[model samples]
Target chain A: MKMKYYSEAHEWIMIKDNEATIGISEYAAEELGDITYVELPIEEDDVTVGDTIGVIESVKAASDVYSPIGGTVTEVNAELEDNPGLINESAEKEGWICKLANIDVAEIGDMMTPDAYVKYLKSLD
Target chain B: MSDLEIKNTPLAECHKLAGAKMVDFSGWNMPVQYSDGILAEHKHTREKVGLFDICHMGEFRISGKAALEALDTIFARPVFNQRVGLCRYNFLLNKAGKVMDDLIVYRLAEEDFFIVVNAGTRAADSEMIQSQLPEDVVFEDVSDLTAKLDLQGPLAADILAKAGLKIADLPNYFNWTEAVINDIPVLLSRTGYTGELGFELYFDADKAADMWNYLLSFDGIKPIGLGARDTLRLECGYALYGHELTEDYTPLDAGYAPMLKLDDFPEREFTGKAALKALPVENKLIAITLEGRRAARAGADVLDASGTKIGIVTSGAFAPSLGAAIAMAYIESGKSLDIGDEVQLSAGRSTITGKISDLPFYKEGTVRKKL
Candidate 1:
């Protein structure tokens, strides 16, 4: 039940056992405005740490969503196809983009904790 | 580049105070979105009300007996027959049948006229018009001295009437009238780009701040930024000058053939009309809606079932009202694509399925209500 860490790119990983749930932070969603589309990585797609795994497009612009920990995409949220606005309504909750199974915990050290992420977001301003 | 000299409108400070996300738009420091966000602002305009600062647009005044004839020769649309207090949408074309700029002409009097041009194309439009006018015609660029504010929505008239102006007495759609709002002389026009019941207010730029504050003091009125303005217009199938109506695009290719009176007007007498008639249109503008949430953008290629590139998108975005991605593009004519025809849009890494749809992606609008 412990949330692991966050990335400066605005991705958050919630680790439970060897599986990790990933989605953008609320801060990122707010800045990006209305989410029009989410291009999630395919299942069983291998992703390395810091590698781009997906894309999020808003009315204004498109941004790449990066992987915080190296692993293979296990499941992608299919609801995004019809309800992209869910990302804006619940970025870190039901709007979770994908799940990564068999993730390498060693890569978590490279990410920041929730408290550090708050400070990291402030540094951007 | 000296930060590109972000010119400010009179409502620049007001936008900042409203927590708008400011961006540089063609050298003008303008708000792109507000704290309520582009979606909210767009929805407000569609369902209720939204106010916009359009002062950055350029305005010009022309007078004299020769002015009417000079304008008729300069624009692709007829101007001399336009009655006083009425406005007509027209385009300035190059000799090659390409559009130089799309503008609205307001016939102020028998010989005087006011031209409202796009903000980005002001200098070029003014220079082109001036160069084309006869020596006897008097032309003056009045952009710097004028300010424009567009109040648009279903409640626009009620809001204006509450502001001490009797909007009921104003002219009908595509018409204008002179009135005083709180002792401030203003030119009110029942014209807007959002496809909503709206009014465009023209007054002295020096008094813009006062008028802006006075309008905002009312309940349910909010300042909308350029972001919402664009989305609303796109939903209505209105073309953005630089994006859709460019110097390289002709009126025929942009779905303006109905407006062209080629048979009766004669191509030789009008600027660019001959070239337009000669250059057989290779493509036509069409509206498309994606099957899913993934939106196609400008520069995205339109492909046929065989993967052959057929066209390119001019403007695209996620339509808040429609809850889907919509776009406008020019596709090869005679492609057998009709309403409900399936197509594919290639956005680099992925291709999205789309269907040909009618313009004005959003259908629920109160733009042309009968008084």
Candidate 2:
């Protein structure tokens, strides 16, 4: 229920008090139907914007989920390791991939707001 | 990827109205699934009946005085003496003994043959077959002119019967017969990609949309798409073109050497006979059933318990019927794996452990069921 920021690659990030949580947008999850596996990043691992953090394999294809903001990895959704379908069920809430600390809020300008992303998704069609 | 033009099938409009998710499959715009989703569609095909549009597959007509001889010489399997009504699973091989494509040879008559091949390899297979045939052979690429539909599952026959198809006159397994459904002539064959009692109907491309709509009108017949089609075939341990049978691998590597039938037909000489006999089979295809919900996808590295790489996964999917993830891999020849031997697949950053299972991860398919 936080204002979500979406990336052009279809990943969404929710920031609160310098802590950023990230997951793939609903658009991305629906496109990649039946997520069979998700490779989550490790805790304490360093990540930067545009870094390839993990891979998500769906029924159709395997894709790299990129990090939208620069920060230190604090936690990964371990539930995804056993049940990646959680992402398909609830992409925005329980399906959050990872949480990042020490976030560079300046990068938010490069990302799209919820309304802007809605327009962005339509342009893709 | 968008630079290449995507082609639509004759039934594309029907799929659009049915709310199907269209994807570019081998240059043809095809539906990956309808609104029912893959799991529901897959289960429906097992319990009820599901219809699939397979117009993307390539069909060729080869007829001549030496048609059987030309076919036998080109394919790896012995196509000669195949009965007029029976459809024989055949293969085309390169000079290097590698599999070019796996096809079905439908003997319409003594000298006339109907060959069905993969969409991506259609042009290449035509060229290869043409090069080996004499000038008198009539070769026609009917892919553009033909459309195919597969009606599968336990209730397929009943549904087709209700739709005005002569169920009693239907061909036996791997056999073909000319029939009419909704007044449209079709070459009906009791064969399907799904491991179910099914019928593959072929007719004019222009009638595809009409036939598709007509089939849907029957009770318990839902439209299935490629997503369920892939999982259904995988559960049945069927080899797909790009996944299991590829240009880099031979039928022997895919654990289909027994189908070569050299013991029965020792005198038959196919295109890659000498080279195939000369080459050593360095790998064997194994079916692995995972322990959990995760699937080991294609290109995933297969490693032993010690973490040493032993093979590469060719195809993997979550088998809904079995409630486990399954995969087919080409393991090293000398590495032996028992039914319970534990193996790991490097699925991205995570590794999945599984056991080497038998040919069909899911048993009880009605593929060979007699009515």
Per-model TM-score, in order, reads 0.94, 0.91
Per residue, candidate 1 scores C-alpha lDDT tens digits across B195-296 of: 899989999999998998888888888888888898899999999998889987899989898887767666326688779878888778999998876778
- The per-prediction CA RMSD against the true structure, in angstroms, equals 2.1, 2.9
Give lDDT tens digits, candidate 2, residues B1-371.
46368888998999999999999898899999998778889999999999999999999999989888888899988887789999988899998878889999999998899999998899899999899998888999999999999999999889878977666777889898998888999998989999999999899999999999988997799999999999999999999999889888878888877888766887888888888788898889999999876788899999999999999999997788987789999999999899989999987667899999997877889988887
Candidate 2: which docking quality band?
acceptable
The pairs that clash in candidate 2 are: none
Give the residue spans of candidate 1 off by over 4 A.
A1-3, A78-82, B1-3
Docking verdict class for candidate 1:
medium
Candidate 2 wrongly placed segments (more than 4 Å): A16-21, A39-55, A66-83, A97-109, B1-5
- Residue A12 lDDT in model 1? 95
Q: What's the residue-level lDDT of B310 in candidate 2?
A: 96
Candidate 1, residue B220: the lDDT equals 82
